[model samples]
Target chain A: MSSTLLNQVAFYLLSAIAILGALGVVFLKSPVRAALALVANFFTLGLIYFMLGNQMIGISQIMVYAGAIMVLFLFVIMILKDQTPEEDKSLFQDRRFIFGLLSAIVICGLIWALVINPTMQSFGGEMDRSYGSPQAIGRSFFTTYVWPFEIISILLLVGIVGSIMLAKRKF
Target chain B: MNTFLNLPLAGAVYEDIPLGHFLTLSLAMFALGSIGVLIRKNPVIVFMCIELMLNAVNLSFLAFAAYPNSHVQANNAFESAMAGQAMVIVVMAIAAAEVAVGLGIIMAIFRYRNNVDVDDMNTMRG
Candidate 1:
């Protein structure tokens, strides 16, 4: 009934939802369904960010990912008439299957290595209380990371212009 | 593994969430994303998986930044703790831009080919 126990339970539940949603994104036949699953995953990940004390990132995750990006995906899927080409049934025979298996093995190996390695273990630390706050993030953004901040704005502007150029039917 | 599972969280608060737990979760998510990218032929789905992987990496960065002995927080400087957060912000911006440009290209391709199957788009194949 303690706060830590609550956090642990929430963490486990959210992670389960995230993993399931991720699986749905990959395996679901309908692109719309897959996009919906991805929305769930993004929302859950946003919650996890909040739990990690990253309020700003958490909010942005929901706003940018769940809101803007997902809307774009849904719009595109709808425009494409929701036609997801059927998946091939022969699993093991496909060359892509081999690639999938190889990558899976590599990932599993990496996980195993982390599990066995002593140095990779987590060490307890005290976080600055205000580190994850929006105010703190804003201060650091304006002061320490101002250059990158400006660059990002320009990059976003370029993306807007480029997307318009590409999607436009006429010059 | 037993030791990790038995990490002392009895008296721990929110901040006491074990670093290993975060790392393990991040790795699992990353693996899932990689697998999704490898097997799924849908470009949109592949893009979602890439976003998942990026989120997983962000989790690890936040975990490390919160670790007391991490290099970023070596001197207990408050600004240093924001390093990972700043990086994540930048990554998020890049990801947004990528999605915009990527979807634009996908739209263009769909207009030309009338299909969204990436397998059919072999124009670059030498």
Candidate 2:
């Protein structure tokens, strides 16, 4: 089979898995179930990244989000240990649900506009291919995008300090 | 192999997959994630939804990185690929930090309240 056909097949198949898993994340009431669905969604997203030829991003997607972060989420939920004996029945029809539904619709419409708008269509075609490789990315990071790179490092440092502060009982 | 047989008709039009397709899928995922954030009362699920949205944005950024239009004049493939990949790496790093801090807050809240219900956060209101 031609390479084009291979990519197409891969994209749609993976998209199905992703969309369904995302739906599961929203619909499942149990935090554990939702977290599990999210793991599936992250894996499907990794496949999409792979198809886009950002192999490194795909690897990171799996390792960081699916493997580490999500497991952390699950562990926390488990430790929370069902504190409420009443099952929180009102959770089903709360005000947050209605508001969330509205926000979702608005977000979806806006995204569709950005994606399908004729003006965006005129922006041009495929990007330069060097964007896919490791060496090129490293050069760009140290050069034209150096400021943002440093800023992100600072952000991570702040996050580390902030979380420690927040988690500390007397800080 | 008729790989296109499994794909939608739009897949057949391009010799290689287009960045637009990735963007659209990413957007779809983002919207779903947005819904998840708004709809879920559980703080942990809300955090998961936020992560999903971040990943969606990352996908689009990677798409642009992999297929830059700037090199249309010279058709220089290597430079565009490198630029895109570089941006994705940076974004991933930022995302990791956000998750760490964000989840840490959730853990602290759970410790104090013994409840993860996001709606209960309204105590700050006057």
Candidate 3:
């Protein structure tokens, strides 16, 4: 078969895996198990990006998210050295569980409706073109979005400082 | 009955799945993550759910970048796709910083309270 057909198959498969992983992350009780599930989800998402032709994003998602962020999570988990605590009874006191269930049902219903009826094809019907390159992203970041780029750097700086302060003992 | 049963297999070759498929997948993932955030009590699990939501948004943006029909139809595909990618870049940066800060807070709270339950933080509710 042609390469495009290959891409479609890959996309469907990866998307399925990613969604399942996300579901696992949500449903799992142990934080460590949930974190592992998140890693799987990230890997599947990276594969999806690869199928979409954004090789750079695919790689970054794996390297940054699965590698760096997850390691950070595991490090914190280890330092805390806490096994799964008793499930917090106070958690079920509120109507949050009911709310969450309702929200999920409503959202799923909306998605099913949209998928079946599909009146508005708002996003993707253009001719196939290569919008998948690092240079393109770089140029745009340096150009119109330059201010926001600088702002994001500042935000990072603040986040780092804040995290350090919070983690440190004042005495 | 024959063609109906064989339809998916038949047109699987020519039928290029569009951005909508990816968007729907992303939405479903995001919803799962949202439920985790709402339902789960563990701090780390909550944070993981947040990350999942971020990934879902990133996926949607990437799909739009890949198929910039809106931009292409308007004769500005290159610039529009770049715009979408730039947004994702910024989002990833912010998400990274948020994770760091969030974990730090969790660490401090754990040190002080010996637990990270969100409901347990209701100290001011006299």
Cα-based lDDT at residue A35, candidate 3:
82
Model 1 lDDT, residue A112, Cα: 55
lDDT of 3 by residue, B1-126 (tens): 455433332213213675668778888888888888898877877888899999888988877776655435645765676677777878888989999999998888888778887757798898
Please give, for residues A1-171, the per-residue lDDT of candidate 2 as tens digits.
766676677788888888888888878777788888989999988877766656566878899889988888888788776852223467558777678777878877786787544324333454343343456556777887888889889988998898788778552
The reply for model 1, stretches above 4 Å from the true place, is A91-93, A115-122, A169-171, B1-15, B70-77
Q: Write the per-residue lDDT of candidate 2 for residues B1-126, one digit (tens) a residue.
A: 877434433212233665567777788888888887776667777788888888888877766655545436445545555555656666778777877888788778777877777767899899
In order, the candidates keep a fraction of the true contacts of 0.53, 0.53, 0.57
Return whichever of 1 and 3 wins on lDDT: 1
Question: Which ten-residue region of model 3 chain B has the weakest summed lDDT?
Answer: B5-14
Q: Share of real contacts kept by model 2?
A: 0.53
**DockQ of each model against the real complex?**
0.39, 0.41, 0.37
User: By DockQ, is 1 or 3 better?
Assistant: 1
lDDT of 1 by residue, B1-126 (tens): 366423433213345466677677777778778888888788888888898888888877776655555433545645555888898898899999999999998888877777878788898999
Winning candidate number (TM-score): 1
Off by over 4 Å in 3: A88-95, A111-128, B1-15, B70-74
Two-chain complex of model 1, DockQ on C-alpha atoms against the true structure: 0.39
The residue-by-residue lDDT of candidate 1 on A1-171, one tens digit each, is 766777788888988898888878877878889889989988988888877767788889899999999999999888876555677777557898688878787866777576624435446555455687889889988998999999999999999999999988652
Candidate 1 reference-contact recovery: 0.53
